[model samples]
Target: MTTAPPISPRLLKGALIGVDLFNPLASIIVFQYNPDTMTRRLEPRSMTGADGDRGEAYRLSGAPKETITLSVEIDAADQLADVNPVAVASGVGPSLAALEMLLYPKSLAVIANAAIAAVGGIEILPTSGPMVLFVWGPSRVLPVRVGAMTITEDAFDTLLNPTRAKVELTLHVMSYNDLALTSPGNALFTVHQITKEVLATANIFNSAQNLGTALQL
Candidate 1:
């Protein structure tokens, strides 16, 4: 019935926590993963009696994996002791800890959005011309262009999965929002084309940055 508490926020060293298309994080050549606690279930089995009669079997549920977030496991019940309460004590108050935790999701969202834009653009128009490069991140939206808009597909994919196994990414492009506007002498960029391009290039850059940082580290 006992379980371990979840680990606190720890800054990933050398490599920045990126909101790329992956999450185990691309900078990881390998990691000593401490798996979340797991439980084993025990249930009764039905059998036929010597009198040629059988009994119905009942099902049982096992212990649960402790949840850290709504969809994630913090870890098992046993790993907390070695984790250093003194180190975690600094974050217990409602000041810095609460503030940082509140900001975490938004930070993730910003990075996720930006990565999506950068990746999508680079993937579709890796040529360094005519196309727009948009980088969406937690703090700002930056535009990236390889001189023009010339981006190589190989380069983009390479950046996302550089080690071929760095799979922690979370890239996402913003969806199209249609708006009515006055035309500048009957201009011609269609909603479909723009949407397609933007989504295509969204996450490529962040993924690339992630991979680049990982490889460098």
Candidate 2:
């Protein structure tokens, strides 16, 4: 039996080269222009319960949400000069066409008929539909759905096609525990567990050391 490759997000985060975002479906990369910075956030569900003696239940009002925001640049000057294979095959340079390919899959409306057929044929819908990955390092390869994208076209060719762009992309992370028990998801889930354990252990160690110092033990 072949063991699944470990999902390591930490490896990506430590590199000075910066993070990479990619669409597994489109098979296109945005490594040419790395983002200036990336922001990660967690939106916890609001707490709610009955008033008075009824103690508030400490649980997520709903599933917690994670979001990542970043701005990436796309410039096709190299493609325009030397004929990039991707640009040539895409029939356009690194302008709107490339951006569209990178982003469209996220919002593409599912064909209901095709989806129905797929379920009937496979007995279950695939969990990996047009998902994008925010690869930071080894254990930090996060799967996310594109939440929003803003495109600013700064330059264009003579014919009015875009040449340079600044794209602000926001991604909503897919919570690991909710994903199907598949390859990357499974590996990612293992990483998540390891991270939790490490954090807990560190906290315990720190607390014990502090207590020992206070008591002069």
Candidate 3:
């Protein structure tokens, strides 16, 4: 049987890019996602009795969530089409220019006249924050909020401008089990549910076949 290629996540603006994380408006692109290790977390709740040797058995409180840490390389030297044009300006090398572009999206910036409090009911300009998305292969594509990002500048040019950087991103997957069904945040939760069910069913069949019906109870 022939297998079909996996599909990448669609951005909020409708374009599809094969990246682990990206912010369309900010022009941040993570071309490759490295060390794909996922951590599944289960929150257990235990009951206690007034008089008992040990507390009551622990039960799973809710659906499990996952966390993944990715190591991504960001360079102004990379000449991919997705790289922002300003990063590859004339006179200055692409890599140094790229670093400038990279910093904008992740850095906290305030818009003009965007006061925390508005007087006389004047409309306040909303401050722009990082727009991040987390995609884990075809099985999981999620809209995620950034937890932590550490950028390491490993290389620089004669001008002392950072040309290459290694960005470490720790992201928290926003699950739908805790959100309203109508909300878009639940999309990944729905996908995770399907993946879990399918794997469970497959395991049962595989185990039964290996053990054989005659040996089964």
Clashing pairs in 3: 76-95, 77-95
Candidate 2 per-residue lDDT, tens place, 31-51, comes to: 455666889788776576455
Sorted by lDDT, highest first, which candidate order results?
Answer: 2, 3, 1
lDDT of 3 by residue, 1-217 (tens): 9899899876332111212233443334434324444444444333434464453445444555555566666556654245655544421234223323433433333423433343343566553443335555566666555566677877665566665677666666556655667756576577777898999998998887878966875
Identify the candidate with maximal lDDT. 2
Winner on TM-score (1 vs 2):
2
Instruction: Decide which is better by TM-score, 2 or 3.
Output: 2
Please, what are the lDDT tens digits per residue for candidate 1 over residues 1-217?
9788998986432111222332333211112232233222322222433454334323322112111111111221222245545324322122222212211333555565667787774433221111121222222221211121111112112123211111121212121211123521112223434554787798789899999999999
> Whose TM-score is greatest here?
2
Give the distance in Å from residue 155's predicted Cα in candidate 3 to where it truly belongs.
0.5
Model 3 segments more than 4 A misplaced: 1-24, 36-58, 76-131, 177-180, 210-217
Each candidate: what lDDT? 0.29, 0.60, 0.52
In model 1, the runs with Cα more than 4 Å from the true position are 1-70, 75-79, 83-173, 176-217
Q: Ten consecutive residues with minimal summed lDDT in candidate 3? A: 12-21
RMSD of 3: 8.0
TM-score, every prediction: 0.16, 0.59, 0.58
| Deviation from native of the Cα of residue 77 in model 1, angstroms | 4.2
